[model samples]
Target: MTQPHHDGPRTSVRPRPAGDPAATAALTLGVEEEFLLLDPTTGESMPVADRVREALSGTAREQSRQEFRHSMVEMVTPVSPDLAALREHLVALRRAAARAADAVGARLVAVGATPVREAHRTVPDEPRYHDMSRRFGPVAHDPAVCGCHVHVGVPDRELAVQVCNHLRPWLPVVQALTTNSPLHDGRDTGHASWRSMQLERWPSIGPTPHFDSAADYDATVRDLIATGIMLDAAMVYWYARPSASYPTVEVRVGDVCPTVDDTVLVAGLVRALVATAVDEVRAGRPAPRIRDCLVAAAHWRAAHDGVDGDLVDLRTGRPRPAWDLVDDLLAALVPALRRHGDLDLVRREADRLRRDGTGATRQRRIMAGTGGDVRAVLDHLAAQTIAG
Candidate 1:
């Protein structure tokens, strides 16, 4: 693999206000979501991402980019302090992507993995992705999987590392709530998020262990890269980690939600969680000491059953109803949510998801209604992807 170019160190010269800590360290948020492009009539995966990119050229070039597979594309939102504004930006971007797909005789579905498509044969014409394909073999070419990554600003690297440790246990809960991929290769995988399982094949992809300090985190990452297990910091696919390029901690647990409201809900919860963790560190509280093995088990359970069955509650390390665990997480983060003025919105959106079920459940229902027709599942996902 060719070494990536480095632009040298960036030194921030901005002045900081003297008085209020919260005012100085306000948490901003952003989201990156991936989608699969498919043939509109056949619901089969389409390698038309280049065409979609061409359609979005000059208008949303900064907002959208091609992914590793030609069947996939990713959109990223600019950082915003307001959740509503973030949702609006995401909606506009999704609409733009949908229009671009339409112009190319394709459709965009925002599920975690394409339901009917087998492994994507065509890799994007990029050096890094080509290296990944050559190194990882078939795992890199599997049915394109998508995810929703939330970045919450923590400017301070030490705080970001501490927040990553604090956020580790709760990741499974978030994953359960955002399970959007239950089918793979035209059949039910029985796992709520087969995408999670697929990603776990990579060495660096899962719950990260607790790091005592920022230095510790950096050393661990450097060691991993040195071993040839991964190529660079970008390949450290932990469920939550400090962003390599941005001054934020990125949470990469959740599946790409189909609905705008659901995506907003996940982003809001992620920001609140980061804010809450920052407060805990500021207050001199020690990070939670959950064992990494238990955390991995919780992640596995969430990926397997989603919110439909049981989850290993981190508080007790015992199996509990998934919704109960979700409620517990909300209650735990209430103070942060209230502080950010996102309490009401998060509550309402979460309640709606619980009432209607998550994307995985909806996909199953749609498939059942259409006598297990994968096209119906694709149609439902595409409709929900554009609905808000």
Candidate 2:
């Protein structure tokens, strides 16, 4: 469907401050990560998010928040203009969160989903969460899934919308790189990202349709809310969207990475993608015209196979090796990466992930090597989560 050409609510882009070094920097970005709290010995999900929050009261309190489930906690970093600073901030936040979880007799696991949690019975004490539980029933409570959201600065709402359109086809490639959930409810789901499958149960979550302008995007979101399909703009859980609370475009397609380096790699690549999109817009290039259905199929294929199998390459609408797609993605972002002085770091991290396998592959290997012991899988995840 073509987007309606109408001017509606818009956020004005502000001019950069004189002599502000950040204005000349590549792109400011931030990452939000959700983690599962688990008992150290049994590897079972622990409903101690409130306790962890209390433990983090003084230090890093602003950076951490409670998720929908009591078994999950989310950590967000401040805006960072470069990869090195981003890594430092994220690592410190992870360490502090780990310490808080440890104080509550639980450990944080950065896997996409808890392997042994059959159900989530403890919901946060927030009113919004209560409403969600009442409205969604089992699907809301069944999710112990965690994910990583990357936000790249794009102050102009129009440019942000255009960037989202340009970014639609590449999101599946990001998903494939960060597939960390394989086992669900103590059994292999035969999919790399079982967390994604669980999240897809939501009515408003998935690939987004093309929007010609910010007004078109706003109209679509308003229409969905008007139908009572979702509560508000926050519920528009597309893989990529303009952030409602910030002047940035948020990429919500990646699983919560198990290792800090993986998170940094994904963040770098996402920033590069946003930069590339912005450059395209400046060059008067229209966004790619791939159909929403094709984009959705690509996401499904990536979530199903991850880096271990073929993905529906958006360039040709044909299946291709996931690794090859990753290479192509890197090639597409080379100019942006080089401009940002992050090409070497991104390349090294990608190579490392390719050699060692993604979190999903490693989790499967642990399960197989341990004779299908889910506890061993949890142990590996915990170790990796604290490895940085």
Candidate 3:
């Protein structure tokens, strides 16, 4: 894609207002899930996206794209009116995607980070991924990571940028709670979500600053391009950004959870969080700093302990037990949860995770029983994908 002219003035282009009830109700939900292709029986990385794509061509309803192409594939569900519909679309699409993979002597596995990724690996060359690897060099070539992204539609571009900026502080919280990648190259990386550290190697990855308007956001994006650090706004790989082609802020921090229920709950939480931020901004309420800092600390804890460490209370900088922080986050998000009509689903999944722990916990347990056999772990991951 050709770069845009860089002559626009950099000025704040704030949205109409944040909390207008009219604006709040105008939001919509979408999801972008990444999957790994692997040998069905041996559970090793497999470049089967082409075959999967060929099988799904003219068959699947979701918009499937060759994401890092070959070893990884992504499917985007159409924007749904509510969380329930979003969940339904994703569930159906995942099932079909899995089936397509199965037909090609491969299986689809949903993961935050693949257990045995070699950063230097590349799939069969495709123009997009090829250009990406050429542009990013090592960061794009790294084959060990994957993630789950949620896109909530904003009524206007300015609102979308505001929502993305306000949502930054909490980005780390979502990262920590959804931290799932525990193994890399068949061994523990000692980080809950190794993917976060892996992505940090890219040029524009991490927490983003709040922008006053779409023009300000656009100007900031232009700066990244002029510096030659990224090819375009779409490549600005920050944890969140106003999607270049869509009227939404894509939340890119969460790890791919293991169960269908957890996926739904996480989706609900993301939608609610954005809605809440949009509302608070409209009300002229100061954005919450605790939410921002806690999110960063949460990423640190989750990376180190994988749901086993203490996360700081965003409000006081005091460390709180991980479980307690999870509880508090859920409680604070209740209003947003209710608005999405996903309060019950979020509660159910949160309760399950609280009692059983996140998917990483389960993967660890299975590995222990099988003597650190990653193939066994892959079995669990593959089974979980179908269950979704």
> What are the models' TM-scores?
0.93, 0.93, 0.89
Q: Which parts of model 1 are misplaced by more than 4 Å? A: 1-20, 23-25
Query: Among these predicted structures, which one has the highest lDDT?
Result: 2
**Which lDDT tens digits does candidate 3 get at residues 1-388?**
1223445323233344645567558468888888888876666678777788888855363488866646777878888887678778778878888888888988888877878744437745667667777887867767657788888877566666667767755565677777778888888787888888788788677676555557766777888789888776668776777776787878888787776667777778888888887776566555543443455565666566655777766566677677777777788788888876778888887788878877777778888899998889888888887684
Worst 10 residues of 3 by lDDT: 1-10
Candidate 2 lDDT tens digits, 152-245: 9998788888889889878999999999999877889999999889888898899877886776678888988897868888898888999978
Per-residue C-alpha lDDT of model 1 across residues 26-122, encoded as one tens digit per residue = 5899999999998877777899888898899654668897788888889999999889899898998999999999999989999998777744566
- In order of lDDT, best first, we have 2, 1, 3
lDDT for each candidate structure: 0.85, 0.86, 0.73
Global Cα RMSD, each model: 5.3, 3.3, 4.3
lDDT of 3 at 163: 70
lDDT of 1 at 256: 99
- Displacement of residue 172 (Cα, Å) in model 3 is 1.8
What is the lDDT for 259 in model 1? 95
Indicate whether candidate 1 or candidate 2 has the larger lDDT: 2
- Cα error, candidate 1, residue 161 (Å): 0.4
Worst 10 residues of 1 by lDDT: 1-10
Residue-level error in angstroms, candidate 2, position 141: 1.2
